[model samples]
Target chain A: MITKHLSEVTTKFNPFSKQAKTCRIFLATLPANARQTMKINSKVLPRDTDAKSELKIKFKDGREMQFDPDKHSIKDVAEEVDRHSRVLNRQAELAGS
Target chain B: MSPRLGICRDCLRKIRSPSSSTKRYLAAAAAATATTPAAPPSFEAQPPPIARFPRTQPPSHKPPEFRKSQLHRQYTSLLRSTPLLLLFQHSNLKSQEWVSIRRELSIALSKVDETYPQTPPLADSTKLQIIQAGIFESALRIAEYYKPPPPPSPGDSLATPSSSPESTNATPDPSNPIFTHALSRHAHDAVYKFKNAHPLTPLLSGPLAVLTFPTVSPPHLKAALSILAPDKQAGFPAPTRRASPGYYDGAVQAGVAKMMLLGARVEGRVLDQGGVQWVGGLEGMEGLRAQLVALLGAAGANLVGILEGAGRSVWLTMEGRRGLLEEEEKKE
Candidate 1:
């Protein structure tokens, strides 16, 4: 349980990089069909690549977006994955009953 | 002479003209007088009419209804009568009888507010008294019905004749104390009732009493075992701390004993064990000694030995000083 919790904290802090940023931009700009394709491919990507950012682009249809790294804001690309992760975690907790 | 005659003619014409002109002038004056009356003098101006307002009647006060007054009276009467009713119910009633009595009492009390004339504001003290009376009455009735019969007369025992006056008076006073103290007394009565009435003695014997009178510490193991025993056992067996044997085992006991000793030494400093010694009375000494022993037992041998050694040293020193005093007195 503790390890799972720690991993979740680590996932939240996963660093933003140029590739993650580029993926975030691509996800924001991709059409819905293209975004879904990216999301489906997120699991096969490099561990260093921001999975959340990659997932966001995969899920949301191409929509232009901007976020400041200095602002510590959630990237548009990773938002969908973050949302899904929250939902899955909650579901898991409920299932444990 | 001709000039004089012309003058006379002119004078005659002038005279005729003067009368006619005078008549015309009088007629004109009459007509003017008829046309206009003398201007009426303006009297002092009348004051503007003052604005009038409609009159309003004062609000009327209505007396409380007869039924309200009657209910208030009944409430007061119930307060006085409830304790008496409870005493009656307690003496000779069964559980069913007591329940009926309680229901009747509730109905009677409720009727106080049912009618219009009897509505006196329920004063706080009166309300509290009523509630207290109700609880007391209910508990007393239950207790009386459920209480066990007195212990059976022993063989060869002389039966004393029962006195009615003393018992009757005594009963009321004893029950009154339970009501007077309210919560604490109620808790005491509840425990008493449970102990007397509960059918399962074995299951309840030790734990029920403790649970009922939570303020009371559980009886010592030796005392409890004796009270609960079916028969006396041979030899003074090591009294078990817990009911279940081997519950604590070696490790748990050792851990508990160590903790106990530590707690004692820490508490002892604040408690001032020396003061207990200074009192020197048997009770004071015994109490202090028991407490010290219990603490040592909890703390284990190491802590207990330290305290015991200190106690022995103090005792020897006191004894020596007493002996020296006695020897000096003998020589003198």
Candidate 2:
């Protein structure tokens, strides 16, 4: 097999630029809504190369959620976040009362 | 009648008949002139009797009430959406925050209708905007409540910082730079969330006028439409160019809701009562400036021209203050 040329490899991946693929990725994985609200430790692909594509979300609360952004609607991620937040807000409200 | 009483018909004739009355007055004047050396009074030159409260109203010195024009009132006052959002924000309960905005708007709209005495039926566009705003606000409720506190950074160990907004977890320390940064960051992030979730119905001039949201950008506005009614979003032509007021209608009102949201967000400042008021650095205001500039250009042509004109103060401030990125150029 012929080795790839430098220019071809360079074109495929611009190290400096995060790709539009990311727009579709972060667009859902950690939504604009949740990103600001949650303490997101990291959003990275799994270390296991053989694993099917998935985004791992590490929250400051020590909880984690995994999903494929391309396959799932952004609402799914946002909904999960909503559930967690609603509970906490409820707790705080109750405590205050 | 007796002459001493000054009521006799002969005396009355002297005053009543013009030629006779003139001669009598001249005789009186001549008699007075001889005694006091004053000139005869001309009948025409005599001043008319002063106005009375009975027949004619007295000249009022009361100044006119300085009432503002409808446009000025519209501009100076917060949009109808503002209180709805503020109420939702201040509401202690989380579940209520999610669904309350729509209920509030509908109730308010109905109240406005009842008060107007000509209860105009709700515009379908206004209905649509209310739904969109409510949906996004639910998402906003999620973001607002679910956020976990960030872990302490290396710099934070030197002193306790009020980095976390959740008072339950934080014991506030004033001097920490890290705390200041975190506080500013949280405030800024909340502003963005508010901007995205904010509904435009409050700023609507109704579908009867040319409708638009000067505060909302074209692309995100399109997104809100797609979210609210995907079929309509697909069927309608993309909202790119500025549509003339009163000409077109759609999710443009919803976009306006978001624009208004941004305006509300930028106006908020963090204050500490004990000592200094604002402690956060305006490090990322360039982004705010760009967003506000886009908003300003978008607003000048919206339905509520006065309301959008209010955004100019925000834009002017952004434009007036040199951004840190540009200042770097000047420094070197």
Candidate 3:
């Protein structure tokens, strides 16, 4: 996952629900020092709730992306994040001396 | 008696002589010339049944020498022993971070112990351990699904002649129905069918660490939560810099930020983070018991009041009627 380009990451999921595995894995995929680099917020809902798992990411360029883990796998989520992160990387390269 | 190499002639002759038993047998055979030699002992006699394996060490389906097997055994015992366990997803915490976190947790728990001096101190018994997810899942299945038969009493023997034919078998076989140890083939076969049906299965994936409490002690739990996932709104605020400067250390703070409490298992029931916080918020067993006692006492008092009210109402009605009748008699 292109965590370097992300400014903040937020997730909410029920641990007992099957669909929530993607969100859990996504959180795990973040770099060990990702907390130092980005603002990470996660909330684990109660078991009785059937709420859909949600993942929201804010990129360095102020572009916000939202994903429902119920509809998307962790792979798709990562691919979407990387898609924007590549553009940001190119911009940084052009701006650098 | 002439001396020979290291011995006299008489000593050499004595050493060379056959025993008196051989001479007596020879004489007896000569005296009873027609006696037939006793029949040689029968080769068909069965030896007493003996167990091929030691009583304590049963053959396991997996190689017992391997680390996996030992871990499986350890996990199974851990699952059985701990009634209250918190599951955490730890992402790449440094060793020093773990050390500082542990030190702060002990300090907090010991403080709880001092506050609740009536109960036995459990600070030392609680531990945080990283686990192999797959092995731990397998052990959880075995612990949840497999119910081994109780061991035979000491007076009873597996090899007893009069026992069932299966028990009397002499070989130490893994497939034997009697071997029900956690690592035994029977346990594996019995627990294999469960698969991912367990409620805790989803949480078992990824790098997992468990904080196990020997008992469902709210004070200890509260202290742990205050350190691990401190939330001021949840009433588990993190220690301030003045109170616990070590908790404010860079390593400990970084580790705590990275770790998230996923769920909990309390008395064999799975609970999510919200439920875990609820448990941590509890006052204690004594407080719960006091609440229960107070409720029951209130109910009892209400029952007495209701019964007395009914009796008093009936007595008042009868007395009013009797007074009216007496007044009527006096008017007559």
Candidate 4:
């Protein structure tokens, strides 16, 4: 999921909604110590609330992306992260610490 | 030895035709035997059924050796045993984090147990278990919906084997209707129609863990809530650093942050997060009993006052009329 490039993640989802499954799985797939490196804000909407599930991510290179969890599957979210992360990787390699 | 061809004369032709009278006698004997019923084979009655499988180990629908089958058995037992349990969604938490969290949770729970020395210590019995959600859901369905009739008692079957003969069969077949254990095909079929329709279905998904209590003790629940979720508005405040310095350890804090409270199942009823908080907000069962008693007592008092008021009003009216009549008589 290229978690190294992520700086912040904000998510809001109704746990009762089936469409929020992608959001839940994405959160679960984060590295165990990801909290140490990145900022994470997850809001669990109450059961009766009919709110839309949102997942927003900020990359290390200042690229921000927002995804509608209802419309996006976990694979789509992961692929999007990887695509952006690969460009960041190329730039870092050329710069060479 | 016979002289001709070295063969005995008796061996070559031994049979002699029976006379008519002899044939008639033989036929009469055969008729007599056929007319009478055969004698009892054995004096002793049928022995108790030779059990094919051990009573403790009933045949299971799936291969019992598989992990999922074992988990199914385990979850069914867990659901049946625990009347009060809280569900959680645990993110990627390191083993060290889980260890510290468990340690802190136990420390908090034991403190609650100390306050009520009269009650059995609940901290030891309460468990935090990470579960396979799909297997768990099926187990929950079986525990909730599958109500097979009680198996026939051995004594009952022994006495009335003639009427209910299948109960006496000593074979371990999965299709046998006599076995009604949770892993039986009957139980699976009973819960199959309502797949994912359970009220707790949504919560059952994702990486799930359960905090189970031996009994629905509100004090323990409150303590657990404080240690695990720790929302002050919910009335579950985290322990102060001075009070529980270990709770402030880095690993414990990290683990606590990763685990989210989903909902609870209390006494066979599914509850949302709010409902779980409401339950934790209660005092113990004794407190609930006291509240009921107080409510009923107040209602009884009100009822008595209403009845008395009606009688007193009638009496006052009659007395006033009598006095008026007496005063008029005096004037007359």
Question: What C-alpha lDDT do the candidate models reach, one value each?
Answer: 0.31, 0.33, 0.86, 0.86
Give the lowest summed-lDDT range of ten residues in model 4 chain B.
Answer: B165-174
Give a tens-digit lDDT track for model 1, residues B224-268. 112121112322132254543432344322221111000001111
Q: How close is every model to the real structure, measured as TM-score?
A: 0.12, 0.16, 0.74, 0.75
Show model 4 residue runs off by greater than 4 Å. B1-56, B153-178, B286-332
Clashes of each: 26, 10, 0, 0
Point out the higher-scoring one by TM-score: 3 or 4. Answer: 4
| Candidate 2 runs further than 4 Å off | A1-52, A59-61, B1-332
Model 3 chain B: lowest-lDDT 10 consecutive positions: B164-173
A5-93 per-residue lDDT for model 4 (tens digits)? 99999988877778778888888989998898999999877778878889999998899999998789999999999999999999999
lDDT tens readout by residue for model 4, B177-245: 446688977688778998888888877788999999989888889999999999899798999999999
Residue ranges of candidate 1 with Cα displaced over 4 Å: A1-90, A93-97, B1-245, B248-332
Better by TM-score, candidate 3 or 2 = 3
- Number of the top DockQ candidate: 4
Per-residue lDDT over B187-250 for candidate 3, one digit per residue giving the tens place of the 0 to 100 score: 8998899999899998887778999999999889999999999989989999899988889889
Query: Judged by TM-score, which candidate is best?
Result: 4
Q: Which candidate order results from sorting by DockQ in descending order?
A: 4, 3, 1, 2
